[model samples]
Target: MSSEHFDVVVVGAGLSGIGAGYHLQTLCPDRSYVILEGRAQLGGTWDLFRYPGIRSDSDMYTLGYSFKPWTQAKAIADGPAILDYVTQTARENGIDRHIRYRQHVKSAAWSTDEARWTVQAEGPDGPVSYTCSFLFMCSGYYNYAAGHTPEFAGAADFGGRIVHPQHWPSDLDYAGKRVVVIGSGATAVTLVPELAKSAAHVTMLQRSPTYVVSRPSEDRFANWLRAKLPAKAAYGITRWKNVLFSMFFFNLARRKPEKVKERLLAMVRVHLGPDYDVGTHFTPRYNPWDQRLCLVPDADLFDALKSGAAEVVTDRIAHFTPGGILLEGGRELAADVVVTATGLELQLLSDVAFEVDGVPVDLASTYNYKGMMYSGVPNLAHSFGYTNASWTLKADLTCFYVCRLLNTLQKRGLRQTTPRIGAEALKPQPFLDFTSGYVTRAMEKFPKQGHRWPWKLYQNYAQDLVTLKYGSVDIEMEFSNPVPTHAQKRATADA
Candidate 1:
C-alpha cells in the first residue's frame, strides 16, 4: 500500500492550528502540510461553543495575533466575532486549502527507524493514515462535545431540561420561564445574566461564591482613543492598557487581599447599595483570582440584578427532585430549566494513546515539558494557551518554536526532536493550585508542571514572552531514517 506523507501535520483547525499552519507555510513556502479538524467546520472552540452571550473573556490585543492586528473597535469581541476573525485569517492566508475538515486523528505512533509519526486518522469517508515528520496537537484541553456533570443523587429522574453549556440545545426556549444556572465560575455567571433578560427570573445557584467584577463592554478611555487615534495604534495601546490594569488588579487581589477586597466591596456597595447582603452574595471567601474572576459584560449583569431580572442564591445543592433541586436550607428551586455550566472534561494531550516500538505510553504518567510539550513525546508540541495573558501570546511562541525546530531540522537533516525531562526534574508544579471545582474534578488526568521554573506555566505574560519567545531551550534532535536496500547485493559483496 502507498503511504500518504507530509512534512508536518497539525491537529485542530482553530486559532492555534491556523497560526501554526501560517507559520509553517511562511517558514517553508513550498513545503506541504495538512491541518486535520475534527469538527465538520473550522474554528474549534469558538465554533463549538454556541451558548448565550458568548465572548472572549480576555482582552483582544494579546488574545489576538500580533501579526494580524484585531481591527475591531471594541477589543473584547464576542465568540462569533472571534470565530469570524480566525476563519478570515485562514481564508486570507489561503490556509483553508490545507485544512481537512471532519478528519479526526485517533492515534499517532513514532517510528525510531523512520523518524516520523504514522498518524491513524478517521474521516467521514473511511480510515486513512498519514506519515508526517512533525505533529502539532492543538486540539485543546477541554472536551468540546460535552462538559463534566457531577453525579447528583437524584438528578437522573428529574424531568426538566438538563443542559450542559458545552452541549447547549440551539432550540432551547427560555422566554418567560424560570431558569436556574448552576456553578459559580465564569460560565454560570455569564449564562445567568443573559438568560435573565428574557426569562421570568434567573437564579444562579452555587456551592461557593465567586468574585464578580463589572466593567463596561466598551471602555470610555478606549472609546476616546479610538476616536482620536488610528485603530491599529489605538488597539495596541488599549490592549497593553487593559493588560496592565488586569495584571495590577489581579496581582493586587492576590497579594494585597484586604486593600483589593475593600475597593472591590466599595465598588459593589456603590452598585448594590449598603442595604444589600455584600458579605453573603458579593464577597467571596477565597482569595481573588484564586478562581477566575467573573466578567460581567458592560456591567449588564449588575444592571440585570438591579432591574430584578436575575438574583443569586448561594446555597449548597442537597439533591435534585423530580420537580426541582433541593438546597441545604430546605428550600427548593422549582426551576423550569437547569443549565449546568459546571465545567469541562480536561483531557491532556487530547486522550491520544501513543506507543513506542510496542510499549504503550501512559499520558497520566507523563510530565509536561514547558506546559506545551510532553516528556516522552518526540517532535510534538501541544497548544496550551496563556491562562493569564492573551491566549495568542503563548500560541504565537509555540508556533514560533515549532517553526524554529522545523527550520533547524531541515537544515541539519534531522527527522525527530524530543525533549529530555527526567522524573527528578518534574516534581514541583501541578496544573493549577486552585480549589476551583473544575480543576479539582479533572486533576488526576491533567499534566503536572515540572520543577524547572519556566517549564511551569507561571500565568504571567511578560515572563512567558521572555522564556518561550526568546529563551534558548532547543535540545538534541536526531536526523536519520531507514531506506529500502538490496540485501542480496550486500551478502554477495560480503561473500
Candidate 2:
C-alpha cells in the first residue's frame, strides 16, 4: 500500500522514454522523474525481438537521436547495436538510475481533483503505485509479449514448430531445414533472406506485395566520412544527410508516383524478368509511401531470391497443417517450420482510459492535438516517430516540444498542459495521413494534423526545427489545483 511520486513518470524505457528523460533533466535540472520499464532491461523494441537477422528497417544515421551521435561503422545498424547505443546513451547521460526495470504499467488514470496521474502497475512483487504530474508513454505500439498470429484454420494442428518473428524462440533451430515465412512486410522479407542463408529452403508467403527496393550498405560519402572524420561529428553529418535524402525520396515517391514506380519497376524488371508480372508481384497498387516503405539491405534479399535459395509465393495462407501451411489458392507449401511475419498489432495510449471529472473519454470521438499531444489531456504527450526520414526525427521533436512546454509551465505557473487546437486544425497528420494499416487503425484516437506538408509529421527537420523544436509555447495552459497534502488520500492509486 506504499506509494511514491515524481514530477514526471515515463512508461517504456526505450529510445523515446530515454530521450524524454534526458530532455526533461536538461530543461529542468531540479525536477525529478522516474522511468518505468516493463521488462527487466532498458531498450524497448531494440532490446526485445531476438529473431535472426534483426536490424534497423531504416538507416541508423537518422534512426539515432539528434543529440547523441551514432558512432557506428554501419549506417544500417542491427538490433544489438541499436540496443547498445540506447544503453550507452542512458548510462553516459546518467539516466539509468531514474529507470525502474520490470515495472509493468497495467493502467494509468488521471485525477482532475489532484492534477496527478495515478499509474497502476504490476511487477514481479505485485501491484504498486507511482503518481506523477506528467505521464509520458514512449511504448511503441506493437505488444511485445504477444505478436499478431491470425487464427489459421488449424494452427494448433501444426505438428511442426511455428514461430512469429516478433517473438522468435531462440532454442528453435532452422539450419538445413525448410522454412516458410508468412506475410510480405519487412519482417517476412528480412526473414526470407536470413533463413535462406542457413535453411535448406525458404519460401516467403504473402497475399499481396510491397515495392521492395535494394539499397547499398554504405553510401559513398557516408563511407568516406566514417573512415576520415571524427566519429561523432561524422555520424551527426551523415545522419542529417541521410535524413534529407530520405525526406527527398519519400516526397518524390509520394508526389511523383510514376517516377518512383518506373524506378522501382526497372529494378524489379532487371531481377525478376518481364514475364514475372512486375505489376502484380513487384509494383504496389498504391502510390509510393502509401505505407511505410520496406528497406532491402544491400540487395541481400534480391540476391537471395536470385540465388534460388528462396522463393516468393504471392497467395494468402489458408491454414496451418501438421507439416506446413496451405495457401488459399490450393498451393500447399510444406516445410519444417513456419514463421508468421505478419503485420503488427497496435495499442494506442498505452491501453489507459482517460476521464475528465469522472466522465470516460472515448478516444475514437476525441481529436489529436499535435501529432503527439491530445486535447484536454493535461501533462501528457505521446511519442510518435517518423514514417519517412528517421523515427528519431519526430521523437526528438516531441521531446523538444515537451521540454519547451515544461519551461513554459514553470514560467507561467501552469500545472497542466494540453493542446487547445479547435476546429481550425482538423487536417490530417503528415506522412501518417497516407493509408497505412497502423495509422488507419488509430486515426480516430490520434490527433488531427494540418494539411501543410511539414506540420503533418512530414519529416522536414528544417520545418520541425522551427515549429516544434524552437516554436514558442505561447498558449493558454491551465494552472489549477493546489499541491497534495498529508491528509490527502491516494486517488486511483496503483502504477
lDDT of each: 0.79, 0.77
lDDT of 1 by residue, 1-495 (tens): 355899889999988889988888987776689999888999888899999988887767778876777777666689999999999999999999999888888889887666778888887988878888888898887777678988777888687898998888989999998889988787887888789878999988887777887776666787788789987787778777877776777778778988877787788778887788878887888777777777776776677778888988889889998887999899999888899878888776667778765577776666677667766667788888865556787788788877877776777766767766643555746776677777788778876676566446677766766776677656322334344246744766799
Clash tally for model 2: 7
Give the Å shift of residue 110 in candidate 1: 0.4
lDDT of 2 by residue, 440-469 (tens): 755565545556422244456667778776
**Highest TM-score model number:** 1
Q: Runs in model 2 with CA error above 4 Å?
A: 271-277, 423-431, 438-459, 475-495
Clashes of each: 2, 7
Query: How does model 2 fare in lDDT?
Result: 0.77
Off by over 4 Å in 1: 156-159, 223-231, 422-426, 475-495
Q: In model 2, what is the error at residue 245, expressed in angstroms?
A: 1.2
